[model samples]
Target chain A: MDKVKLGKEQLKELKYFIYSRGFREPEVMMEILDHFACKVEDKLTENPLLSLQDAIKEAHKEFGYNGFYSIKASLDVFTRRRYKRIYWQEVKKILLSPINLLILLLIGLCVYHSMKWAYNNGFYDSYFNRNIVSSLIILIVVCTELIKFIMLPRNNGRSYHISIANTVNYGNFFLFWFFFPSRKLHSVNEILVISIIAVLCSVYYYITTLAHYKMIKAAHKDYDDFKVLVENENPLQ
Target chain B: MEQNQFVKGSLATIILKLLEDNGRMYGYEMTKAVKDITANRMNITEAALYPALHKMVADGVLSATTELVDGRVRKYYSLTKKGKKETANKISALRDALESVQLILTPKIANG
Candidate 1:
């Protein structure tokens, strides 16, 4: 058996392995591999029958792959739980914050005023009261808004997830206006204003969602390249 | 070897114990020590060792220092005070477990 030397290639492979495995500390990983190589070399000196490859493999097996995986899995579970706890804590902070709650209350008041206007003008009684079609449209709009509110961050950051959420939100609004009873005795000016709002929302939604989809695709591509790097380095060993 | 079917639970203890005895060691040295002590009966892969070491550091069970050696900077891990105390507890637990099992399995000798 040829003596196992820690060559440049092996170091590179070890570095890639540690990085791919999500250690985040490449310097520490290299140090560990150096020690592992030295130990394997020492074992080789004692037992000429034991090959370097076999020794390394034996050392790793004693460490136990499944054992390591379980530890990692537990850590992942712990981290996820910690993240959830922290997320809810942040949400609690946001909800409890007087300014945020005041803003939310003001938005609620705006929505209430809009509903009251729709009710007083006989728009709600005429168009929405008797027809299941109008009711369904209202339901769809509400559902879309609820979903958007849940999925999109409150701060209105232009993230891909938020953009997709907004698109669904606007699409529902457009559907609502398109299906609204236009033949009723009402002002065309109000209808036009609402239609314009819907159109603007739809345009923003469309552009943002497209940009978000492109970003999501790019991220996946980068991750795929990282996976390929791991496979190339390890080569089933 | 099969008696120790589950290895993950003992890894932190093993690492802490190794570092407690050795003063300071890197990932590979720790792995090698465990393997050599087990006489090739146990193995730990790079995948397992790095994450455990990283987590240990994160959790304050270990402290690390980095130095450049042989054209590469290597990080070495040493036990914290908490880690040393934890290692003592682990050793006691392991010892108790072994004793209990041995007591249960030992055959009584006939009085001659």
Candidate 2:
């Protein structure tokens, strides 16, 4: 069987046909597009008189009753798993690196000293502590939202890394429950415990922040690579 | 041939073995290679092939890279170090199973 390549116009039409089938992400579309193009080209080669639309329909039919959406659904499952692995790898790096551990300990010590000083300086009232916790929560929520706004739109919502980063950002919500009830410290030991917990949470926050930054950086690289590949394929465009 | 049922359970193993032999392969190319190798006795459908490839990738048994070919991006999958080890294990296991099945189907006659 001879090889037949689809022209630029045919490629564009095929792309629009796939986009119409509800694949919005360019990454997903690219894979599906290549598969569809290969099959349609095969069909056309086998029968030269077959119209491109009919060939496309035949190719689509080959995906069976679930159609191309099955591929997307399966791909999503693997993609989510892959990103979760990446996020855990990031967390492990933060936990395992000696330098990071030292920074975490330093942060813990600073927070502990600051809380102890506050307790001795007559600023340890429950009302004041509650206000501080609330303010911290508010700040974190605002910062998370700001990061999402700044990072997400640029990816065109195509990256699983960005989506996982968004999910990790929302993990900050647990701080409300963890810190809300324990606002007042009854003893120096209590302050110490709270400070330790606070420091750990802050480190977790730092981990996620760093992870989000790396993911967004990776997402940008993915976009850039896609652009370069597309340009190589069609330098004029 | 009705190799679908048999192929379903061993798809990942077959894929691993293929990559072990071929070094790297894209989706359509893998399907074509299987057909050619088996003389069309076995067919790996697109619906099954892509998901299997993606699952191996997620499992860290394979890594994928893309190249622009004929104006479209083609994703080529290659086995990782873990996958190399897995291929050896799977092929050994598959051989043992096939031998067991063959014995069951045509049991050796006992000496009189």
Fnat values, candidates in order: 0.19, 0.70
Best by lDDT: 2
DockQ, candidate 2, vs. native dimer: 0.74
- In Å, residue A131's CA in model 2 sits off its true spot by 6.7
Q: Encode model 1's per-residue lDDT on A1-237: one tens digit a residue.
A: 665455555455544544565544322243345554565565666686885567666544544555234444543443343333333444455567787567556544544455335534655445435223344445655775676556633321112222233223345455545545444424557555554443344433333333433433443343344334333323223
Model 1's CAPRI class is incorrect
Candidate 1 segments exceeding 4 Å error: A1-237, B1-9, B19-25, B36-89, B108-112
Interface RMSD of 1: 6.7
- In terms of lDDT, the poorest run of 10 residues in model 1 chain A is A154-163
Model 2 CA lDDT for position A26? 72
What is the C-alpha lDDT profile of model 1 across B1-112, one tens digit per residue? 4544456667777788889889999877776787899998887655556777867876678988766554344568998888887889988898787788898899879899
Q: What's each prediction's TM-score?
A: 0.42, 0.87
lDDT, candidates in the order shown: 0.54, 0.75
**Candidate 2 DockQ category?**
medium
